[model samples]
Target: MIIENFSSEKRENKLNQLSAEFVVAGGGIAGVCAAITAARKGVKTILIQDRPVLGGNASSEVRLWVLGATSHMGNNNRWSREGGVMDEILIENLYKNREGNAVIFDTILLDKVMQEENITLMLNTAVSAVQKADEKSIEAVWAFNSQNSTHYKIDAPLFCDATGDGLVAFQAGAPFRIGAEAKEEFGELFAPDEAYGHLLGHSMYFYSKKTDEPVKYKAPSYALKEIEKIPRFRVIRKEHKGCNFWWFEYGGRRDTIHETEEIKYELWKVIYGVWDYIKNSGNFEDVDNMTLEWVGNVPGKRESRRFEGLYMMKQQDVIGQTEFEDAVAHGGWALDLHPADGVYSELSGCTQWHSKGVYHIPYRSFVSKGIDNLLLAGRIISASHVAFGSTRVMATCGVGAQAVGMAAAVCKELGVQPADLMEVTNLKKLQNELNLTGQSIPNIPIRPESNLLTQARVTASSALTLSTIPFDGKWKKLNVSSAQLLPFEANTAYAFKVQVNASEKTTLEVQLRKSHNDKNYSPEVILESQVIEVGAGEQTVDFKFESSVADQQYAFVTFMANPALEIKCSEKRITGVLSVFNGENDKVSNKGKQTPPQGIGVDEFEFWIPERRPEGENIAMEISPAIEAFDVSNIGNGFVRPWGTANAWVADLSDTKPTLKMEWDSEQPLSEIRLFLDTDYDHALESVQFGHPEEVIPFCLQNYTIKDLNGQVLFQQSDNYQTINAFKFEEGFSTKGLLIETEHPSSDVPAAIFEVVCL
Candidate 1:
């Protein structure tokens, strides 16, 4: 290498011009999912992220757990975990990184994006300028990378702004809102006043580890010296670490976008001050050996600029559970909002209100109002400040962004603007495309005509008859009210016998309950109540319910809290069956029931949640005149997940070699076969910090084989953990009949499948 001589000239980085069919800004979960989905749809796409890694707030730099519809199973959204590309990412994370290391998660996101050949990923690159083809549409975008000293100009027909702050949309002259609206604006009763808070704040977290030797920490002169200034200082405990301190926030009243760095500095001072108290203050236990392992330099921003779109989601759309005609995605995280003062305020950290069921988000919310070629993703989507509280969660944003990505493909195919896809016929096509990929749009089932499996005569080896749930000698304490959610048909009578051990003579209060909305799992409709007197020892209690409903629904056989009794639990785990407890999950809900203030425009409901794996065992009980709901014909029912019913065909527990056969009238050429398996959608797969108990969902089929008419094996797989297992033949084969043999995940859990598609 040779030294260069100084010259009297200005130096500029090399400029590069590139073009793609679709362009996505921001490398957060939303943008990553959008770019991946678009690429998979055969669209040439470019993903640009300013950060060094993907996942935005969910990245290692700012580690926030990824949560969505299930809301950590803290509410009544049964089987409501998001599906599609987002689901694949979460499942892969669980399979390889169950420990939930944020850094490991980063690699997983990168790996997923790399797997798609149509995608070009650019990391550590920020979009600096927006070029408009006209006053209403985006023509291209300009980005710069300091690390490489390069500038890029990317042109595209369509653009998606998933940059969290709506940078692209903002620069393109798209309309956006920065603060909360008054109650009169959208008729949102939960709308906060100006003094309470208009926007959610930014938060920073730190990780600490215990060392063999004592470690000392010294606060800098700039670090906050007075810890008592924070109103909720007493909430800090020696055990509190990482995301547990999500309330360590500030800068909601200030400009969230431009003042981000200033807010981050304030958060650092607060974190250092809290650590200084933990190490030096006399209010804690033995923390002498505890040392700071990692502290986030970047703050996780919650609220920023929310852009305007074709339609703006409002408060009623969430709480009322409105079903949109052009529904593309769903969200169920509580309508959670923080005060303007953040950590400094005395308000109870956040005010949360949950819906009885998941609500639909329309496609119109993703298209920019005035910008023709621009699309909105992530927290920047068109939504009122009231609705943004729930839609702002990462997983919800991811699923919605998936819709945007898919819409881009449809737009390109039709050669139309985003708004054109909103037409009834075009919208249905878009929805069908999304459903084909397993995206869950609430209240919308797959269309039967599209699936070749629907044309075949379906038959199974055996079907499960709900006769009894055998006890495994394990007793579950009735310290919290528990219930068994059983699906029942209309005009059916069911009798159950439960075994319970009582510490003393007590009255066991049992109630039969169901949701007012048959599709929801909230136990709001109490059909009947029975009180049984128990002796001082183990005994059996018999109860019966005669249903007189018009439609099939899940009934909650609830046993109210009685500390003196312990109910028997079954080791057998089955598809579409779960045991729930009315309890508190501090992560989402503080109390078992949500009793919002009267005018808040939110419903009051009790949270019946299931425990995670190795703990969420069903209550053991015997039912008279067995219920037969898992029929082989369910495989072509069009619904993939539990919707009002199991919507799955489960084989008998004794049938070790479970098989499903499909026969056609004539020989047909099959090129590809897709199977949708059960993945315990109830389990919230948080991407980081919260580790899962198991790698694979217990209900998934671990091993499976597919054969032609003469029992000759065509395809087989082992160690499968994903929900969608697909097989394709390079050269298609003609078959009169098809057979699928599957092995159960374990002996106790029966094999189950939702839907099968042949192409």
Candidate 2:
């Protein structure tokens, strides 16, 4: 496993400077994700990649689909919510590339690096040499980009080697192990009896589509004669339709550069031969049009030089045999091995060994053991051959990136090197940050809920006293009973009592409900009780109740003391309809409806009572339509109208006659009124109003508005106007026969109200 430098020429031409807080080498998935994470944490970061594009193996040149653990597995499950940067990339590409699956890979990787304002991407740049002032710390590095024929000397407090090749560790003189370790070292069951000269090979991926039309094919220009003797040259079913990565067999045994060159030439020949066999070889004739969609220019290397981190992960660690205090990531993939060379050669064949559930990955595996500042990510992390076999996948590599970036930020913030930051406290902080961002970490068991009580207090006023108690525990079962002991009941109606020490005469209204779901339903019964005020201290107040309770139901007790000492009974019902629409086309129609009402064209119905109304009550009609994509033809014109304007009004039904009661002792109450529609195309109110007679309140209007002070008579005919005022304003507003106006004149209206506000 020897790597030749090839040249000593300094390709870096730029001045050396200390700028970024962190420097990330390699523009692959791991590197880019690392840069993104670091930048998101408010760190000034720089990303350096030898390739022009950000994505390394999954780039267009090397088309590889990113794979995580099995869809159903836990611990090893893919937690994509860790929304620092990678999540953003996936979402952007998922929306942009609807036709091309591979495009998603490229788009996601590029977008992450591009969107981060704190991250600087240096593409087509390769690190030439490491500048270290101490045995463990890297002061800066010299980098050269062949594309620009220039050099750059970058200085940073933290450096990451996401290059998959572990180049930084190689240059920094890190103590890294390349080949398989002796069995005595790790004691892994899968390890060879002794160290052996064997390594997994790389592959050049290509995609093909089978069509209906007939077509001829030829083998790749680099195909070898030995390929004809291979037995596994076949296509397998994949997730995508009409697309397969089946023709990927090359760069094994022989020198990668030399073999890849040869395989490139032979692939075309192999493809044609395979297609010919399927079409004309008597056994198969249905397959005629085989289309080649993509071919990899760069070989997808599986095994390569691995950096030696402070801790070398072994297969035992993956078998759940070891626990690490500094665990930053978890791996669960099986031990999959690909032969080193030759078709089905004894040592170069594919084999797999499954392990137990989840394994811990230590932070030491990220930073180079010999060099202090350089942190390695991706498949090149410090691990034995067998261990690397289980963690080499893209998803695992992304996890490694997250760990390294988080560690780098921690190091930068604490003024410590990555190696030193591997302490338990620092690592825990890193793990917390990763978990907060949604990355999956090894689970540490947590005790069930205890210490249920959070806080409790009572607020007293002359008229009314309100007491609120907060509980942290999840409510399992609740009951309310009195000494006039109401028996504790579950999911049934019951009256409860509390002993109170009162100083003066007072009346109490007792109710029970859960905090979160409390306001949702009205209590079956409200117990009325009286208490005499005490000088001080505690007092027991008993409440009596009659019960015919149902089974399997639960209830909590709540008590309210009437400040005014008045008795009253009432019932209120809240109702509203949800509308749906096509989000993509802006089509207004009831379709897919969501809770809290979300969809392309959905609207929510809401009601509000204002304190300023005469009855110290306010009534509001609201239509909250999703307008993120709504098209308003004209600011003041083309406004959507209420279903029916004349019948929408807020009034006090408590009066002898519901004569538009607009005043209340507590607050100003609005009376009955009708929403009017002016036929003049220019004067359609975006929102209609029907509150206090003096206030021509607007309802459900777009935010924009226009004015018609010029008084231009656009419509002279009286038939164009509609006056609505048929319903009564009650204690609670109610609607019947209310027809929403969905259409309005196309002309510009004076103002379009997006929402209604009653003050």
Candidate 3:
């Protein structure tokens, strides 16, 4: 059945006028991040989302956790380093709801992009058709919103198809491929010998809140009762909370868009039926009131229309067989395929292929070979079915988004087409820019540490022998005291160096043992045959061992008997300090040692600031202040009270007037300062100013400016209107004294700052 709204007139007036330099179609994670990246680079960017919210699948509608690389990968792995806008979103969300689970993904992501002034968001809008003057380039695109019955004709120099489904590419006449490919085409190991009308399945996620009281539930009409009797379906447990492609029983070998709607309805039926069986069958008698919390409105799509670009990513490239000069992104997810027959079967088993480290994703995969300006990102990038399976994860898609966004910015700046940016020089520049923003670019090798053990010394009463070990040079000798213990653990191992002032040849036996029940367990010492030689300055030794304690326990070894040796023992002790607080008004102390007033407190504390000072004042102090837990109505009021200052004031501090200062031990370079203000209280802050004292200019500037203490302007902005405005300083610039000048006089506005963070 084809349905068309013939009476609906295109209301063009409701559409926002095209004024941005770049336009991003789709408001999913990739689209939002793309828009934010472009806007952060000072480009006028407009983000168009078909839904009312941002985050496509990872939103409240889908509720998918954001997964990155495998656990064996390094912390700074390729998938983990896709920063820029994505990092900002994660940091903001993590800071806001540190204790809560990862349920606030959509709200946090949306707020990040929506908060940016340069990013104009158009929600509930769908791209209808592309208007191109030339076959190679897009002049403008027409979009319509059903809610408002409006059509938008957006014109921009550069365009990004972050629409997960390749909607823009398809509408723009870009050649694309969908479903699985034959093995000979991409030579994918998992691909069938011949092309089959099959593709990965989509899933509709649902969540249930556990309870104690029994609640009855009814199975849906479409519940697969007969299929449940099958061995494959019977063997699988339905008690687990998460259901991905496994719930994908059907919807293959059909029109994806059309089948998706029907699949969603069927999936919902199965989901409710499972819940009903659990509630009524007495199996979940203890689980009372197990109500459905969320049912995914948007299906988590696995396969889609992949646009054919200058280069097509193949399975061999993903298997680490090929490398490219224009590599801009990488992926490492397994090639997981769902059953094509729409029923649980053994063939639905997921396939895994190991790529040693990161695999390259070329820049040519972004823009279509058929269309010049249209750059496709996210899961819709040009890749064979098997390759797409690996690169289709959210983390890999984020990397692709970063590449496309940076490419779009470069094209807009250089006045070149997307295809033209694939040259070595241009691609290198793009890679460098992405790297600076902390985004991972593939094939650019990472040099390992030359020396892992730097200045290693052993402090023990017994004689010890040190041996040089060979392994991957990439491992850095992390500070032993900085190692963090996992949950259900008490202590961490300590290792360090010892120096002998006086020359005394002594036998020192180094040992490794478990410290439990107030006694050493399984003690093993590496004894030296001869007396160890000691130098006048310092004797360095390196030793590595693992603990055998169970349940994430810790162990440390001490000399069995104190051996007489003229040496100074330097053992590495845990340096990080943890503090707990009672309430907003209570003072926080370190293990009941030093009590400090806690106006603003945090549950967990990890201080990385190189320097600390009052926002305006320059006097510095070296104090490892205890991290406290407190709550403030506003962040400005949450700070340690300045000497002789009583109340919080909002004044135009951009100019030299109304200066404040903070003193700390070290010097920390600041990119931006976030001032959390209590807008609900007094509604102060008409206009604010901030800059270093050196660049004193007595003018009521509308935007904040980054300057040195000597008053040299580094950067300036006029538009960000959020209360948490981050004044970013240019590279190679350092400034002190961030003044908050207000639009109204200090006497008129009563705004208070809760917290001031420089990141």
Best by TM-score: 1
Quote the positional error of residue 410 for candidate 1 in Å: 1.3
**Residue by residue across 1-759, what tens digits does model 3's lDDT show?**
998666677633576557578889988778877787778777788898888777786666665554443312211111122344554454454345433233455667767787789888889998888888687778887888888877788898888998877877887788988777887776665677888767766676666776666445667678655446333544434445545324544456556666789877766766666666556555544556676666666777777687788888877786543668887775655444566645444563444443433467888888788887788878898888877877787766776788888888888778888888877778777876665454534435211121111111111111101111112112211111111111112233333332333334444443443322211111122211123444443345333333333423222222222234332321111111111111111001112111223421111221111010111111011111211111121123322111111112332222233333332233445555544332211111101011112111111123444444455555565533223345555675444343333232122122233345455
Scored by lDDT, the top model is 1
Please write out the lDDT profile of model 1 over residues 546-645, one tens digit for every residue.
6534678888989999999999999999898889999888889648998888888988888898888889899999987676778897898877888888
Better of 1 and 2 by TM-score: 1
Q: Which residue pairs in model 1 clash with each other?
A: none
What does candidate 2 score on TM?
A: 0.54
The stretch of ten residues in a row with the least summed lDDT in candidate 3 is 682-691
TM per candidate comes to 0.98, 0.54, 0.60
Lowest-sum lDDT 10-residue window in model 2: 451-460
Which model is ahead, 1 or 3, in terms of TM-score?
1
Model 3 misses residue 713 by how many Å? 15
Alpha-carbon RMSD, each predicted model: 1.4, 22.3, 17.3
Query: Each candidate: what lDDT?
Result: 0.91, 0.48, 0.51
